[model samples]
Target: MRVIFAGGGTGGHLYPALAVAEELSSRDPGFEALFVGTSRGIESRVVPASGYGLELISSRGARGKGAAGKAVTGAMLAAGTFQAMGIIRRFKPDLVFGSGGYASVAAVCAGWLMRKTVVLQEQNSVPGLANRTLAPMARRLYLGFEKARGYFRRGAPVVVTGNPLRGAIKPGPDRDARKDFGLSGDGPVLLVFGGSQGAMTLSRAAAGYLLRRTDVQAII
Candidate 1:
């Protein structure tokens, strides 16, 4: 079956969505999955690298310097609804899965309007606005935290799947990856990753502190 994943403001949404994709892949290698997110969201980068096709749309959350700004953004989102419908028609997916993003609202709504199955995966302790609005209309809801359920509207069946994560993300020894980065293997080693997808400042601090130690060897 074909599936589309929507929602991606942060790693909170993108990461969980990817994890679910990975799980489906493990279970059925032939399942096709596509991801939909704003052109600027982290998913544009992470999803492709993970071997998933990504469809882009112009969408931004409601924000403004004042009420006027929110009003204009709301107008854009309204237009985006039709744009999302076009995507659904072209994709012809059996199911649409929403992760979390303003872009997703349009896409999921269009899918629901078409009577295609729509599933929501809530990643935060509190369900975000897009999911909240779509919950009543979706066919199924999956949440990272059960506590988030009380926040959704009635109608959809809810399931607690925890946060879906790609199997490629593993916390373990870096002996293999280290060899590729061109570093000596004599001292204490630390892997530092920071960007939109992680806690860069904390990793930087920890690596810096470790490097200063007389016993330690390196940081990545």
Candidate 2:
């Protein structure tokens, strides 16, 4: 089966698609996958590195924009949708999967317009604007958090499937994992990360906590 996976801008929006593609490839050697995203998105680098074909579309975030900016964003989204439609036509994917981001808007919209099977995967507790707007077009909506269900339409096809993890991520021996981080002690170790795109708030909070508790070794 051929699938078109669309989403990017951050690892949070991109990695889940990669994980699903990896799993499908593992199960069916003949399965083919293509990724659609903006050139500026993380998918530009991540998708090719993961050994998948990637098609770039024009897109920009409309959030935090003024009237003029929103107009420009709308133009870009229209261009992106046109480009995505071309890609979809040429690729003829059996399914189009959307993870949530500005990059997903065009491809998902194109898929819906073409009457293709469209699916969405939302990774946050609060659904993003793109996913919320495209939810009705999706054949199925996979959510990372159960609480996210309430945000969608009452009868929407929402399924609480936790975020997909990459095949490369696997738990190893505790000592080995600690050693990799240069921590040899048996003391408690803390892992702090602000998702794929680092958050200033999380960084500041973690710093304050670490300062108060020097006993805890953290990998940020």
Candidate 3:
């Protein structure tokens, strides 16, 4: 099987796409997997690190810019679309899978145009713009949240698959985390991590609000 996965911009999108690629490889050892992503995004690093050959297309989003910037971004997007087509023509994948990002946008569109099956994974409570735009062209759309299904048009592929996670860490609830952290029960417990979605703002606010609370015990 020849499979191509195009996704990037964040680990949330890239990780699941990679997981699917891994599964595909396991199902068929003869499978050939290729990843398409922007040279600028995190996918360039993460995709190759996952041991897949990555084809980089030039892509940039239009945001917080004037008309000139938007025009330039549009031109870049069009050019990258052509580049994606080129990749598809050369690779001739049987199917293409992606998550969500500008990178996925170009590749999925090209794959659809080339008469290849396209599968997309939309992994958020609210589907991202790229995934939504590419949804109609997709043969299958895997979703993380069920509520997001209505957003797609009629006959669009919508599968409610819970979030695909990797290298998950689940600390036992009965493990007595207080003892592990050497904490006292006199004060509230505050946990902070920078990487979680919308986490920084919530973590800071939670830390500030609960640090003074003498009764709360939780994880953030």
Instruction: Give Cα-based local distance difference scores for all models.
Output: 0.79, 0.93, 0.82
| Model 2, global lDDT | 0.93
Winner of 2 and 3 under lDDT: 2
lDDT tens string, model 1, 160-203? 87886677667766676567667666665655655543477777
- lDDT (Cα, tens digit) per residue for candidate 2, span 1-220: 9999999998889999999999999999789999999889999998999999999999998855588888899999999999999999999999999998999999999999999999999999989899999999999999999999999989999899999998899989898888889996678998887854447788889999999997899998
lDDT value for model 3: 0.82
Best by lDDT: 2
Please report, as a residue range, the 10-residue window in candidate 2 with the lowest summed lDDT: 192-201
Looking at model 2, the pairs that clash are none
TM-scores for the candidates: 0.74, 0.93, 0.83
lDDT of 1 at 154: 58
How many residue pairs clash in each candidate at the backbone level?
5, 0, 0
Task: Sort by lDDT, best first.
Answer: 2, 3, 1
TM-score of model number 2: 0.93
Worst 10 residues of 1 by lDDT: 189-198
Candidate 2: count of backbone clashes, pairs at least 3 residues apart or interchain? 0
Name model 3 segments beyond 4 Å from true.
Answer: 167-197, 208-220
